[model samples]
Target: MLSIEPLNQADIPVTASLHRDNLRLGLFPKLGRHFLGLYQQSFASSPYGIALVARDEGTVVGALFGTTSNAEHYRWVTRNFGSKLALAGCSAMLTRPQVALDFACTRAGRYAKGIARHVGLTPSGSSGPKAASRPVSVLSHIVTDVNARRRGVGRRLIQGFASHATLLGIHRALLVTEEGGLGTPFFERLGCRLVGQHKSQDGATLREYRLIFDEEGAYEDRDGGRVAYTVVRAYPKRLGPASTRPQRP
Candidate 1:
């Protein structure tokens, strides 16, 4: 039987491995498995973070990491694991010089702010975007093992994450994935709407999607647990002209 639940500390290593193996397009994956482990640990440790895993008979088959407040989660990670993560990052960069260049071109400034936030060099309010009165959580990463693909593992993990987010008073969840990537259709199939598109630090075009939860209805998983929201609407806006409009799943 497959089960979706909060990720335990003991499972961090496996979750990190899954991330490294399946989510290779991201910068964190290139930082190596140790860095990925710490990254997952930050989510597992943060109060505002959501870390979950899908297990089949006690073996981890999929994982999801997200944050209710990105600013708070980053602050917590910087305060608690700053030095260690920095050391690991530096070590990785030293061994892989191209990684260093990629970081400089993409994430250097944001990371600098994180460091400044940790040392009180910057005001708390300036860490990132100011928090809204209502919560809007971010779905940062979700991946399933190769053997688990097409078996509903990814869907279960998403439902589990959304259920947890709703319990925290979040009415909507946001995520960004590579344009036309494998994840786009999957998210669209689950009723996420493509809200916008932007270029990443590395100049790759990324698409942002939002999943709005209807508080009145719910979805039940195979295990009979209620997923707090059901996707009921369709994508009404088009990203381009009718000739180029993406098809719905």
Candidate 2:
């Protein structure tokens, strides 16, 4: 049986467990308790952050979690991080270690130099002066137990997330995930169109996509706020699916 519900404390253990198995299978390291604890906290914090679980029989097989920052959240997040901050230098390196070592070093240097010219590291030329006035939502997490994959659990989770966006009156939602995975196909099926792709040494690719609802809500309209997009990336490097003719199950 499959069930969809808002996530609560009780579901954290199961959600984290599923998250663990899916990524570690691809040579990813197991997350320590501290990270897992933080993960749960962040997942629950997003104003529109929501979770849904799919169960096969009595076992939890999949989960979807995401967030949408409202006007208030956009104000808070931007005020602190302010456009073009320097603190993320280490994270940029950690996430893209596979690039040419020299290139990575140069990019880091460039990232630092470019900061003064850019506000909030945002694509918009303006980021600071328009903080609290805008509303944004960030969809942050999604995972499925490996053993239960290929069974539409992922697709259903996407639907659940869309439903949340619909409820929030958000006409659109954003999330980034590993490219060409089960999750990709699932999102595409649900009207989530691919917006862009970013790649790095670990063979990790961040694919950003947006899902727009029929008539519920819309994204943040603040002056300098941003669109919060959930990022679901944690997979082992592997040969992509072959071009072999499709075989019906």
lDDT of 2 by residue, 1-249 (tens): 777666667777787776665643221223332345345544565454566677777667777766655334434333444332223433443554643354455455654444533434545443564553334554656777877777767766766776676566555566777775666776665556577888743457878886554322223344444343332221101111112222222
lDDT of 1 by residue, 104-197 (tens): 9889998797679756898755323223343557899999998989988988887777678768766567899998777888888776867799
Would you list the C-alpha lDDT of every candidate in the order shown? 0.77, 0.53
Q: Estimate each model's TM-score.
A: 0.81, 0.57
**Lowest lDDT 10-mer window, candidate 2?**
233-242
The model with the greatest TM-score is 1
TM-score of 2: 0.57
- Candidate 1 residues lying further than 4 Å off, grouped into runs, are 117-120, 123-131, 216-249
RMSD of candidates 1 onward, in order: 9.4, 11.7
Reference-based lDDT, residue 9, model 2: 71
The positional error of residue 83 in candidate 1, measured at the CA in angstroms, is 1.6
